[model samples]
Target: MPPAKKETRPSSRAGRLRAPAFVKNHRGVKNWKEAGAWLEWRGIEDIECITPDQAGIARGKMMPSKKFTSNTSLALPSAVFMTTISGGYPEDGNGFSYPEDDGDLKLMPDLGTLSEVPWETDPTAQVICDLVHQDGRSVEFTPRNVLKRVLAAYSERGWRPVVAPEIEFYLVRKNPDPDYPLTPPVGRSGRPIGGGAGYSIAGVNEFDELIDDIYHFSEAQGLEIDTLIHEEGAGQLEINLRHGDPVELADQVFMFKRTIREAALKHETYATFMAKPMQGQPGSAMHIHQSVIDTRTGRNLFTNEDGSESAAFLHFIGGMQKHVPNALVMFAPYVNSYRRLTQAASAPVNTKWGYDNRTTAFRVPRSDPAARRVENRIPSSDANPYLALAASLACGLVGIDKKVKPDQPIGTTANEDEIDLPRGLLEAVDLFENDKDLRAVIGDPFVTTYAAIKRAEFETFMEVISPWEREYLLLNV
Candidate 1:
């Protein structure tokens, strides 16, 4: 039998009692004029307009409050969306290249994503933007736009996806040298963490100050963060956000990552969301829990009125099982991401589904009929949250539309003989590039661009000689 569900506490202790009036009313500063006015009202002097690049990293300009609203839109080069994770152009030219010269694109503020930069020393604010072509259509390669495209598909089907993300990361002592291994930061007790402390209240208290600041910053940014717990890795923690619209949840996850990094810096530590940052430790992941609801009745589409599992639910699982192998590039994009997927690493390595089974890629958590959902455990923390959420939802939609039926759910344990996931970035990229159905749903342009970027990153990684190679192969071989 599946483990019994436990009542979880709200993650934001500060916002749990009651939220401030300003926070309640702040539904993202809606337009250029409204954003400017909100910044002015908050005594903010600088405003940063950011858009997620192909790698999910924020790239944008910081503008003076006075000059920002004067222009209707921010113009940037189209090439910005095609840059590799290492800040270099792809070997085979970015597909968006113009014959004459680099083309220009526009940045339109997504007013719903405006939030104050709580960790900044100066009065500053930031808003996420949507990349738009000169023709006024959204840029196909942008991570945010990709998510919007998938969400639009759901809307056309009279369905909406609700998503909640569980983000895991580690706090370590600040280290500038790439050669040195990271150590857990010294907590309030002035002792560095020595081993894994999953679910230990004492572990949480040790880093109370940093965790507290994270809560405050999350509250200020209006991120609906809900539960906090110590994960299985030393100094690792997980934050759970309440479920809501897929787009809104993606935006919140994007901001929440930046917030945690900034807060860690302020507390004299460093935070890394890398999938596997340390040897002999569990890796961090961005586990996405998802459900769909009817647009008209707002009823849970995964559950039937008779309280049994719905066909839509099983078909959704089937879709994920069939399509996840092709979408592996989005879930584990980096060279380091695959290191976390090893057996016994608390990461899923196959597209098996089970009832509350942690070893499976898809797990159906025990919940009430209305809350029935699927938890995709494949994506790592290093993944671009926008792309990951979009891909996951798109797969489920494909299953529902085609009426795909999943095989019987694994009871307790996943089959050891099940097929393994792509072993590395190269394999995953190949799978993504070759999959026709996945490309159709996630856009051909995005699939091509993303695969190129990951290929470039993988090639760069291949050129490096690690210490392990020198230690083992140099003398012996």
Candidate 2:
């Protein structure tokens, strides 16, 4: 029998006390333009905010064939979406249009595709849309479409990929006081909740209400949450999702993040997937487990006669090892991401694999032949699930095409040979940029776009003079 459940109550934090103004507004799509204007008045630079009508068009939900009036500004990418919502563009049509607005076009909602955000107050509501052009050409550069294309590749071959993820993150205090350096805050008792609890079930239960709220939020938002467990680090936790198709899995991960943020805010806590939020403490990771099945026969492709990995499984492993180095940027995208891939401590710092060995870059859980699959433990919490999944599958396909055979296992740290991994985001990007085969696999657009984003992030980090530099250099100079 299960243990007796404890009494739980809603958080009484300041966030819950103050009602957010936008919660009850029911004005049709018009509210979006107003929200945009409101943001713009506050000096928000990303002027791309949408009107409800434009949102309808993007979601292809319900576009009235009549034009609506609103002189609202939005960010460039957001504005592109707004154009679709306003019936000034086709939902799936492509060709970039900005700064040129033709007068009076009907907006229509397309129901063919839609994604839901679990953190939204309205759980039943959907964040719907499709790429569109004024000239009726669907934009190919949209990130959502990229994942769709990759998922389609597997679907076409009747191979349905099931994926689940364990997203680990830290909860830090939002310190706005200029007097203090940014750090995790103490509870009312003067003891910090973020300090030292390694995989303690009792520790997680101590915050039972918070976890319950998170589970409720997930269920309301349609996320298939399997369990929430305490992680090895202080103030860190892991939320695992039930395995599903690759596309659904990625969507679940993206939605789960927002849910965490919203729930944290209500509790006066800050949640982050920043990979390494604190120095010395264990960092967060986003380990993904994946398996493929034949759609028609419902057969697990990784299984063998002896209930072991098939040749196809071995080939997939080979592809992952071959491309992991080049694809490191996608798995570890941010500057702080590299800090998480240290040797041992359950983090993989080398390009290697082993059965049930968490120390290696990849792990094949000991399973019956019918349930075989690969568990990639390299990606930190900062990884973009869509990009990560796409790159991983691309590598697997390459291995299959080349019939690449994996070498013997790398074993433990004692027997593991010295292997190198990127020490920083720039080095990872450099590795990615120089890899011709990986570039061909992921396409030029993805590689270029990823490099540009990562490069910009690195530059931002460089401009900031850290506290360590000030403490050491200011006194010496």
Candidate 3:
């Protein structure tokens, strides 16, 4: 099937938000403006306006807008960007344990479900609300809101950033098959597990029935899926979402991940976004493609008028390079994420942009003056969409503002002058800790907390002994 057309917000002259086909498909949203209003009424605030610059500075982190307020105390600021969905218990609270977790208080509401009034008994109602602190301050950790704020900066420049993500994940064999209780390690791979072949599109055809269901469910959930194909692993698949604006596109990415997992469970399968779920198999990756458009004239800012060096394009690449190190934490947040940054297999180990080069950290497809743009190949599928997009934009915008210029494009590989991305989560944490530019862009509080969280996670992993240890050490010792 041909891909759908790109959806844009209604022309400012129209004086109403443009309803995309997917959104309009929702029962009775006759007018787009009303839908935007509906979101406002449900406590959905625009990221740019709602994100507390003061709070962000206080948090000292990038994308602090995703944080939520504390439920127990209401005296604090109620305004926040990211919404939280309470599921029986509030996350990170004293009551989150046994009985306190089953409380009735909800932080924020999902705007998509606004048409259904008084959503008391709706089993599907996630009680998903904005993240706010007890001080009524917005939650800084919310990933969705972070991207929203970053997109706003571009919008103010009369440019719209179109973004698409190729998300790869594993559909692993459920260790203890639920249906066949006695059978151990027996999994219905729709064909057979570890059946020799790799990148077998036809092999995955056997699982099309379930995969198709995933596509349809995504459609129903207002997700824009462009393609789905079997990956190199035994039970791996990739789903790509059609790109749009950074904020909207990032939100779609998040929803897509949620939908894929939820839909997979219905078929009694386990879906994982882990960067490297199995050894000796191709890992999952999230390849991001991006382009920019002028908000006023609807012109693509990345394109050049006379096929000359476009200031915007150069500055954008410069921004990406300048902040690549600091953005590592956002791109490869988890320890496992670093495992995917190999030299070959279309994964980038160094920071550089090349024309139509898959090996480069960034790829600018050689296109006509009309459709020129860049692709960032660093991020993994498990990356928080909000943080990834926000960090990229923050870096790119900084380059533009500073008029930073990049050297001759490095195609496929890095040179002596080129810098490498942080090789591991530990190194990434260290870079993030001392990076003044990134700290200035995002803030201190968030960086400190994020580093702390990641350090804690690393420490926890260190305490665990894996099969690799047993296999190598048990026999020799």
Q: What is the C-alpha RMSD of each candidate to the true structure, in Å?
A: 8.0, 11.6, 10.5
Judge candidate 3 at residue 15 and give its lDDT: 35
- What C-alpha lDDT does candidate 3 achieve relative to the native structure? 0.59
Per-residue lDDT over 1-477 for candidate 3, one digit per residue giving the tens place of the 0 to 100 score = 111222344546443434344344431233334444333323332221111221121111111112211112112232221111111111232111222232222243334422221112221212123445545554544554456556666777777778787888877656554333211112445235553435677756756766777777665445677877776666777777887767556656665666677666767777878777666666678888777887776777876667665798899898888787777888887778888776565467777888887777788887777678788888887777767777777777778878878767865345333337787888898887777766666755456655655665676667767777888999998
Of the two candidates 2 and 3, the one with more favorable TM-score, higher being better, is 2
Give Cα-based local distance difference scores for all models: 0.83, 0.62, 0.59
Q: Please list the residue runs of candidate 3 whose C-alpha ends up more than 4 Å from where it truly belongs after superposition.
A: 1-24, 27-106, 110-128, 133-137, 176-190, 193-200, 307-309, 412-419, 475-477
lDDT of 1 by residue, 376-470 (tens): 99999999999999999989988998888898888766635445789888888888887777777789788777777787788888888999999
Highest TM-score scorer: 1
- TM-score ranking from best candidate downward: 1, 2, 3
Q: Pick the candidate with the highest lDDT.
A: 1
> Model 2, range 170-248, lDDT digits (tens) per residue?
7678865634544664444456666567778866765566677788777755567788887867668898888877766
How close to the true structure is residue 95 of candidate 1, measured as C-alpha lDDT?
47
Better of 2 and 3 by lDDT: 2
Clashing residue pairs, candidate 1? 11-226
Task: Tell me each candidate's TM-score.
Answer: 0.92, 0.74, 0.72
